[model samples]
Target: MKPKKILLMGVSGSGKSLIGSLIAQRLAVPFYDGDDYHPEKNVKKMRQGIPLSDADRQGWLRTLNRLFVNNDEVVIACSALKNEYRETLRQNNEDMIIVFLRGDFDTIWSRHKQRTDHYFNGEDMLKSQFETLVEPTLDEAIFIDITHNAEDVVNAVMRALQN
Candidate 1:
């Protein structure tokens, strides 16, 4: 199969990075972390448990778009919580395929609570992420329920792509 650009998108603690890395490795493509593209100010605000406004995210999304522009085949892990953010990315690269990782709030919250050294805390930001999530409609993009193991999730996506 030819490698294609993919966006692994979901809220924090939903395992976007973990799954994206595995998928990228399987596809022999480079993987980028969208968090690394965030401006220092945005990082600081999130570190302080503050939700960022759209203005704060605009530059970050553009940075992600640049990565796609430069790479032929890549997988990116991002908390693309809103439709506008996804649309901006698509505008930059129409071939970009969004892989929406859908997980229940409790599952993500427990995962977040177990993590250490991350900027986002589940208690402070989970609600905001859930609120921001505009679950992709059938005609919008590929959506996957992430209630299974990581490998299983990846396999499911791979199988879906094959069809």
Candidate 2:
């Protein structure tokens, strides 16, 4: 069966929100951007170009986990940069589908530069995310290259989930 909970994870600017929303729309499920759930303090830090520490993100991660626990089905876009963070998210949602949006620093950095509205757009912040990232293996999650066009990337994820 297809997974009920879907998580799109990667470094900042890896198109998690964009692709996750599309996937959720196609599936007729709710879409949640993990960024929106962050506390104001975290938002302020990121807006000021400060990288958040793990402790700063723990509460936010737990909140997202609670969202997952309460929802029947959802598509969530979160960085999930570290293995421990992903574990926290998986607390009660072991069957969740995780899609790792893979892209190089330069590719994601270029995308980050195009954004003017997001709080997490600094180069240093993006670099820190990459440094913190612990990518999942093939056995752990479906991986999609962000170099592809949006529609194609979504299609790839759909196909991957079917198997």
Candidate 3:
């Protein structure tokens, strides 16, 4: 079945925003970046090289999930780093399809470093992200490599949804 909602998940530099936008445009659905939903406090924390504790994320996760509540035909780009976080996102949604964009540290770190205007800074934040990540199982998501070009990633996601 075609998922009513889709989530692109990964670390800070894993291309969630770029690819999510592409997929949403292709699907002709609304695209929401989870980063945009973060509270100022969370943004300030990450900007200062601080990793959010699960407690710190509770409200954020619930807020993201709320965006999905009673909604579908949408895509969201988020750093759903742990199982609990993913669960939070899935709270009211059974037709949510999550795509995990996996990439090597060096590759993603390089991308993060080259970014000019993003809030996430460098290796320190990247390290915290990886440390927090709990690789999703096949049952939970479709895993794609972030190394793939935008076209390839979008095509893959489309194909995956068709199946």
Candidate 4:
């Protein structure tokens, strides 16, 4: 089967990386972490518990668009919280398939607390992520409930793609 580009999106600590990795592996494609594309200034701001403005993210989104343009098949993990951000990516590549990792606040908070090395603190930015999220409707993207195991989530996404 030909590989497809998949964008795994959600708030911080929502298992985008884990699930995206599994999906990419299953599809035999590369997986890119959108965080890795962020400018140093943006990373620094997040490290300082400062939320990034749309201006702060514009460059990053453009970078992501470049990656999508360059690759024929890949998986990307991005905290595409807003509708506009997702729309920006979609505009760059109409064939892009977005997999939204939807989870409740408590679930994400618990996962955040378990993470140690990441720059974002669950308590400090959870509210901001939640507030920024304009939940994608059925018409917007493929939604996956992330209240289960990572393997299950990946399986669900794959099944959805097949149908």
Candidate 5:
């Protein structure tokens, strides 16, 4: 069956929000940018260049997970950088299809440098995310390289979901 619950995951600057929103629009589903759900304290910490500890994210992850539970179909762009975080999101939403947007640090950093209006755009925070990333294998997710243009990337995700 075509997946109705999709989570686009990666470190910041990997285009999760852009690709996820496009995929959701194509599928006629709702799109939720996980960044929007973060607690204000977390945002403040990130804005000050502090890396969030797992404790800081527990409530936030659960909140995002509820979005999955409450919706029949949803596309969420989240930086589920750790396996535990992904597990938190999958609690009652086992059918969720995770799309890992893969890209090297240099490629993502180049993109990050161009962003001007986000609280989590620090180079150190991006590096911290990479360090915390527990990449899901092919069995765990549909991996899409983020070097492609946004349209191409979304097309790739759509094709993967068709399978």
Candidate 6:
């Protein structure tokens, strides 16, 4: 069966929000951007170029996970940057579909550089994000290249969902 609960996960600049929003809109479901859910303290630390510790992310992860508690159709853009984070999200929702938007440093850096106004800065934090990410294997999630245009990436994710 096509998966319902969805998490579009990737590094900071890997198009999670853009693609997740598009997919959710097409699917006629509510879309949640995980960044908006970060606690103010976490944002403050990130703004000061401090990489958040696992402890710092715990509550936020729980908040996102709670979104899937009993919902049948939902899409969320999150950085599920660690194996544990994904596991936390998948706790009660075993069939949750994870879509990873994969891209290299230079590619992601370029996209981040183009952003005029965003809470998270570039490079330093980008490296931290990559350092934290434990990418899902073939059976764990659907992986798509973020090098493609927005529409194409969304199309790919949609097709993967239908599989």
Better of 4 and 6 by lDDT: 6
Model 6: per-residue lDDT, tens digit, 14-75? Answer: 99999999998999888999999999999999888889999999999999999887578899
> How well does candidate 2 score on lDDT at residue 66?
95
Tens-digit per-residue lDDT, 1-163, candidate 1:
6548999899898889899999999899999999888999998998988988889999999889889889989999998888899888877688888888889999999888899999876576888888878877767667888889999999977876676
Top-lDDT structure, candidate number: 5
Residue range 83-127, candidate 5, lDDT tens digits: 899999999899999999999999999999999988986788889
lDDT of each: 0.87, 0.93, 0.88, 0.88, 0.94, 0.91
Candidate 3 yields a Cα-based lDDT of: 0.88
Instruction: Output the lDDT of residue 133, model 4.
Output: 90
Estimated TM-score per prediction?
A: 0.95, 0.98, 0.96, 0.96, 0.98, 0.97
10 residues in a row with least lDDT, candidate 3:
113-122
Position 124, candidate 5: lDDT: 89
Which regions of candidate 3 are displaced past 4 Å? none
TM-score of 6: 0.97
Look at candidate 3 and tell me the lDDT of residue 11: 91
List, residue by residue over 60-163, the lDDT tens digit for candidate 4: 99889788878999999999988899877876588888889999999999999899889776476888999889988887789999999988998899998887
Q: Clashes in model 4: which pairs? A: none
Query: Distance from true position, residue 160, model 6, in Å?
Result: 1.3
Q: What value of lDDT does candidate 5 attain over all alpha carbons? A: 0.94
| Candidate 6: C-alpha lDDT | 0.91
List clash counts for every candidate, in order.
0, 0, 0, 0, 0, 0
Write candidate 2's Cα lDDT for 38-134 as tens digits.
9999999999999999999999999999989999999999999888999999998998889999999999999888898888857888888989899
